[model samples]
Target: MALGGCANAWAAASSASLPFDDIAGSFAKNEIVELVEEGVVNGTGNRKFEPKKNVTRAEFVAMADRLLKLAPVDADMPSFADVPAKSWYYGWIEAAVQLGIAEGKSKSSFEPSARITRQEAAVLIVRALKVDPGSDTGSGLDYKDKSQIAPWAAPYVQAAHTLGLMGGADGKFRPVDAMTREETAAVLDRILHDNVWSKAIRQTPNMGLQLGWQNGLTTAQFKEQVKNSAVNTLVPRWFFLEYGSTPVSNHADPSLSSWAKQNNKKVWAMLGNHSDSALTHQILSDGHARAAVIQKLAGYAKTYGLSGINVDFENVNPEDRLSLTAFISEFGTSLRAAGAVLSIDVSPDLGTDWTEAFDYEALGRYADYVVLMGYDEHWDGDPVAGSVSSLPWVQSALNRMLSVVPAKKTILALPFYTRDWTLQSGGASSEELTLIQQGYRIRSVAYNRSWDSDLGQYVVSYMRQGSQHKIWVEDGRSLGLKTMMAAKRGVAGYAYWYVGAETDEIWTSLSNAIRYASY
Candidate 1:
């Protein structure tokens, strides 16, 4: 019965049929033939796939190279002792290593023919697709019985299991067992099925894709878009009502307001982060109450013609995080429910210290979007050169965050401003000078790159004193790279810390690389 089923399956998979009994009667035989035909899996000497034999790492890679149709840019092999250039699989192994899809067990050994375990095969498939194992679904087969599977591979195992790719005969995932040729084929078939090869060939372009948090229209428009589109857009952070105290001058700059209106984007108001109830009262004290704060904010947004409001209330007491979350939740729900969108910008470490005073997950659910204020490694305090948010740090934050908030609702924040700290006694104090009146002849050394935590920007250092003082400013290269990274990560979109602070080159690079260049 299994033989008949195997033959039928093989026939279904290929355009040509193989001899029914030559090797077809063996379940493993058909799989080997199918894989060989697709050029994804191969056999040993004499055209024998050695069905029922153990598959090794080197042989597996050779198959994968042929299957995935990967092209090596160069033929150079860096000489691993176990995988010498003389080895037939050398070129294939070298290409896999360069692509970061495979690595040797030691500095000089690839263990090419060593039996590959089920978990190792999972890693290969996941790595080839550039899928971060950490980002996979947390559910799937339980690996409690698997002794050789490491803690780090847990996520990848779960991802594969959840997809129904590979499981054990007894309902457990045997991560350490040497994978048999039949077992390897079964897993490969599942992977090929789940991935759907046509997806790569039928890929579509996203050139006209609108992104970020705002649902350009109210009521039905937002409802329909939410149901249909795979991508969404988000608004960046802002101090909507705190700008100027006048009737409507207090909103975002007119140019920005107009840009939002024209582009179908939203705005995030920085209301209570720096505002106290006293400060909130002060806005009302001038004939406007807390209601005035919300009203003036809504009115100005409506007047300037905005699509939404983003609330940025940072450093509230830990106890206040919930209260603030509730307040913003109600505010966002009410405002956006009526049509306009509402978003919130919380601190990077929102899940930990009292400083992280907001329920981001809750806010993510309530607000139209979640603007993760992902910068601020060095606040105004640190004394060193670093990226505002390095890749590892950002990945750590996201790993913790995605647990609660959905990836679709998150928009990573990018910084446009840089800080220049003089190393003198009055160094930090010198920042008190206004952009216009700060003409104190501040000198600087040559430019050096550093990460600015507080402002969430990459800095170019210019020494102000004899090795004592320095100023860090944002450059175009950093901004350009950040934009590209955001797009690659499938985030809703990116939010610049402040559009006004952006230099011409920064804007040019961003627009060319990320924004509407054809416009």
Candidate 2:
């Protein structure tokens, strides 16, 4: 089964077609889906939303703002050093700060990216609800972590628990630990459905597609991998077009589509631009050519019984942003009307030509999901060597994207491969390694492995050929951490860049980390 999802969600998803592929059988499944549909909250945009991934301060505040129907008492977004005005959560922060529901981490900074502790969440929830912090009964709090609760937040924690807005498990509050996205949803749902606040507060909030790419894989090979993986949506690289100036390279195969139906898998055929910026610009800039291209691709999707079209245009010119958005709008309109969906791949905003061409906000509007290629942080030619997609780097990129694209419409793409950078004079050289190769490399060498807290990844270094080799490894440990960060932020689903590159053990680790986690 694919991930559980609301029936209204289009494009792709996780178990049994849930709005989110990751939370099908979770304790908070019903509550999570309901809250997502009601726009009170959002899914992780990936398959699993788990406890290991803590909800950030901004995320908690956004939910509070919506649940409380808050308008920013202070019109200007707070001038916190880390809270940019363009950020999606700043307005929520502004409302939260103005209402005294939250405070900055320091005088100059809000540290909006930091995770919100359990006590912090309780305090904010209680304040937002305007529920009086009821008198603290000494006996009401008996958590194992009681001593860890901050003094200022103690009464609010007790009041929140008494109000049934928050609860402890296994008799431990872990007061200073971060709140998971699912926990946030449970509390928000309680406020609107399970408690008196539902009657007192009349408000509404607004808000996966788990997609895996199939690179030239025959149906047999692809089907085998599906058995061991949690990927419910199949994105096959089936077609290529040159602004429709030439015949589209038709790589369609009916057997794959047939198998998809039998196995309840979704096939989103890709239409790539050959990584030609000029070719992409030609069609995007020309109305006639653009319309013709969309008609052909949408027709192909309907003809092939596919779920949707995945647009993988790369190396686009910055000046073509408007044209790109226009093409997406026109293409998406036709697809939706034909009972199909649209998803677009985008690079992180690095103020470069490769990314400047993408208008994430605009594309997100037209397409059902904007798939962020969440890797290449340290690309092939970069002078420095690092994990391709470090946890912190991915976190920053996700925050930037969510500031524009709605969490529900955003999909984070995970990399199944890592780079082995070989240090050389003046600069460095690197070679791509599959999950299997990287695993073998780590085990084969007499290297020193240590955890990098900042990257949330393991760093393995060794000396050979008179040069020190530093490998920011991407193994089960790193992948799990990245997924946790995604779940923490609350996205729609996740997409592995391509299948067939992972080690055998990778799937088991992925299942444990991204699949069966309880919030």
| Decoy 1 TM-score against native | 0.45
In TM-score terms, candidate 2 sits at: 0.61
Per-residue lDDT of model 1, residues 83-161, tens digit only: 7766778767766664456777875577988988878887786666556667544444455575456666767776666
Tens-digit lDDT track for model 2 on 163-251? 88888999988788888877888888887785556644552211145677887567789878876777888888888875445536778
Residue 435 in model 2: lDDT:
73
Model 2 regions lying over 4 Å from their true place: 1-207, 243-247, 514-518
Off by over 4 Å in 1: 1-304, 350-354, 383-387, 421-464, 468-476, 507-519
TM-scores of the models, in the order given: 0.45, 0.61
RMSD of 1: 13.4
> Which number leads on TM-score?
2
- Model 2's lDDT to the true fold? 0.76
